[model samples]
Every structure is written in structure tokens, then in C-alpha cells.
Target: MASLQNAKNESHIPAELLIARVMQIHACICKLESLKPSKQVNSLFTHLVKLCTPPSSIDIKTLPQEVQEMRESLIVLCGRAEGLLELEFATFFAKTPQPLNNLNLFPYYGNYVKLANLEYRILDENGVVQPKKVAFVGSGPMPLTSIVMAKNHLKSTHFDNFDIDEAANDVARQIVSSDIEFEKRMKFVTCDIMQVKEKLGEYDCIFLAALVGMSKEDKVKIIKHIRKYMKDGGVLLVRSAKGARAFLYPVVEKHDLLDFELLSVFHPTNEVINSVVLVRKPLF
Candidate 1:
């Protein structure tokens, strides 16, 4: 649909506070990275970096080389963080579903449920049902989006999770396998979307994760690639950022999705992210 206003404007958080947060996040990243060469550490570092980004008004480029380099490094780190975070989350929950306090998972799950509800409402309005194939690009380790959708929506029989990290895939599979009932509803694959050449048009629904792309350019490319393989009239649910969350990465604007018919846009009343639902345009 059309672009909507954000629930709140977070730019008023104060420049001094933003600077302080950057320092805190930077120190945390340094400490975590120093501990080991684990993927979890790398993922945390990337998150810390994204959380550290200041508002656009403050130009980080004017800083010293070292500082500028640090900002630059965060860009690269966030791209890797997706797979790394999946690996970390998968390892943590592989034994049990309980999340550690340090993971700060409650907000994450809450946000997922909020967005999933939006997906559910749209599907219901459109008369979408179960036994329909659904694929989640960038499923991460937990696949919480799919899990939430399954629990809340109860539609979409087979949910396929695709990610580049094999470890992440293993974690998702383990989590899904833990529940025999859910086992049949979910499948995890460890290939990048670009690598899957055939049978890509089978899905009735697709989800592109919030952190799937490294940059705006990358996101556009990924969307364009997936658009080619989508079954006509199939729905695409994209989780995008807004307001404060835009600091993590630039949010997808209306122009970014002109190739598809924008069905609707849903902004979370309590959360930071938004959802954009679209359908493929007819071949001319």
C-alpha cells in the first residue's frame, strides 16, 4: 500500500545520549570479540555496531581515520551478523527453548508475534489457507517468524527456511524437530537464494527477513531475483524497519518495491519494525 507515518519519532533521543550509547556498544563489542573467535561474538559485535550508529545529522565521516574506519567496519560486520546471530541463537536454544537473559529475546519474540499477527490478518482477509507452501528467506536459527505464523495463523502446511549458514539451518531444524507436530510444517535449507536455480516457483508465500541484505542496493537486487521465481498472485511479506530501527539499516521505501503490487503496509503499534505485503505483477 502507501507509506505511513511512524508510530513515534525517535530522533529526539538527544545527540549526547546517542554518542554515549555508541561508546557503550563499542566497548561491549570489543570485550565480546576479545573472548573468542566464535560466530556468536561476531554477530553480537555487528548488532552492537548497528545499535551504535548515530543519527544522520551527526556525520561520522568527519571523525578521525580510526573512528571512520570503525563506522565502516560496522557496515561489513552487520552483513555477517545475520548468519552469525543465527548460529549463536541456534546453539543457545538447541538444548532447550528457554532463552538466556543476555540474549534479550523477549522483545524479539514479542516483535515477531506482533508482525505475525499482521501477516495472519492479511492472509485471512485474502482467504489464504494451510497446506500452501511457504518459504522464509533468511530464516535465521530460531525461525521465530515461521513458528509464530504457524502457531497464530495455523495456515501454510510446509514452511521452508532458507539461510546461508548450515549451522543456523541445523539449529532451526533441531528446534522444529523438537515438536513432532511442527516437524512436518517446517524445513530448513542452507543455500543462498541466488544459488537455488530450479523449482523456485513452487511457493505460495515468501518472507524476506529484516536483515537479509547488507545495503539498499543489495536489498533491491535480492528482491528482484526472488520476484522472478515467485508464483503469480503469491504473497510476499517483507519485514522492514522504521523510525529508530532505521539506524540499524535503511528502511525499504515505496520506490524500492515498485515492481510488485503493494497490497498493504502494517506498522506495529508497540514495536519498531513494520511489514510490507505485496503480490507479483502479471507478466505483460
Candidate 2:
């Protein structure tokens, strides 16, 4: 009900909780209902960009119905909060409205595909009905997409999408054979993520994907936690091979711990570094 936490089983954002947050934000913005639609929408997006930029999870691409209701509520609440919200809109979009395009995926977001391949390869090496051993972080459409692709590509690696977004899970369930197939592959849970770093330890391999946008300090904290979970001789299939300049790279080097190697970097469409680094925790 309050920032739910579960790193395994399933990760999800309840509709009820989402509605509550919207209500609260709207109450604060109820004085500017008289503003122009353009100004009002702009104001709302701005506030969203600031207050909810890195959504609790990055798995959700489209806002859900309840969330849409909340957005409407904020527009109706239009006043001082709306004014400030519009300012936020001006700052973020500056001019563009929300795009009508599909999959606002950023360029160079290739790690998901590689991670899927790693999962598939592991399944090929193992068996189906794995006993809740593997854990994936940040499962959104991309990760699930990877799983579907892997399954079709080789009938391997049955993994469930572990994300905190219900809407995302809904999307994953849409593919024809995806329900049963995804059910076998995915075990959804509402995880705190930090908790995952604690409870799950020493996997055969930890497939990870780090991003450039994360703050250095937060990134370090996450890596330190991940280091604790890996089993000795365990491998880390990481996205972003050039991350030696990134925080985790430095931390791994500083501690003189992982045996890191770059597997390959492929371009889906001329994007940079489909960089995939396979890292193994040292035996010592």
C-alpha cells in the first residue's frame, strides 16, 4: 500500500496506490483550472518530470487508466500548483506535446536483447521449471520483449518479467502463447530492488544492465550491493561494456575483484556499443 517491496515472486504497482498519489498532487494544484489547455498540460508534464522523472520503475511505457484519471484531475486542479506545474512543462518538453509514436525507446538501449540471450543460453544449458534461482532487475517491456524473442528464437530460457508496473505485466500477457509461456518464464513480484540485493545471493550468474543516466552515487551504492549477492565463480552478464569509465567499473577495479571481459557489441541500427561485458567474480 505504501511503496511496496518484494524482490522476488512478483513486482508491481497497485492501481489504488497510484490513484492516491495523484489525488494528493491534484489537491495541491487545484487553483489553475482556468488556464489554457496548452499551459495546463505543459504545467502537468513539468511537475511529473521533476517529481517522478525516474518512475519507481522504468518498465512502464504508457500511463495506465487510473494514472490518466489522475492526470485529468491535476488539469482540473489548475491554479498555483498548475502554474508551477506548467513551468515544469515549459522546462521539459519546451515545445513538443507527448509523442504519438510507438515505443519511445531510446537509441542504444541494446542491453535488454543481450541479457535475453544470456538468459536463453543459460536455459539451454539448464532445464525448464527452474526452481526460483535466477533473478532479473528492471524488467519492463524490453526485458520481456527479449524473453519472447529468445523463446521464439530457440525455445529456451523461460523467464518471467520482474517489474513493479502492472500495466507492463498486462502488456507482456498479450502475446498469444505468451500467457502460459510468459507465466513459465516470468514470476512477477513487487520488489524494493535493494531487498533483492540482500535476500538473493550467489547465483550461477547475475545478468545486469546499467545505464549512463544514473547518478554516480546511486550507481556505486547499487554495485556494492550487487557485489555482495554474486556467488564466487559467478558471472555477471553486463550491458554497457565501455562502463570502465562508469562507477561500477571503477569500483570493481578499485576492489580488484571481477574478471571482466567484453563479449561482443552489435548494432541493431547503427547505435553505439551493443556492448556486452561478461564479468566473473574472482575465485580468491
Highest lDDT model number: 1
TM-score of each prediction: 0.72, 0.43
* Residue range 1-284, candidate 1, lDDT tens digits: 10112112334556445555555555556555343336656455434434433233544424556644554445444545544555666676767754322233532567567667777777667656663788889887778778878866764468888988787787778767777778888888889888774556888778888777756678888887887777777777776654434434445767888888877776554543454555544444
Instruction: Output the number of the TM-score-best candidate.
Output: 1
Clashes of 2: 25
Candidate 2: tens digits of C-alpha lDDT, residues 228-247: 66665555544432211111
lDDT values of the candidates?
0.63, 0.40
C-alpha lDDT of residue 190 in model 2: 55
lDDT, model 2: 0.40
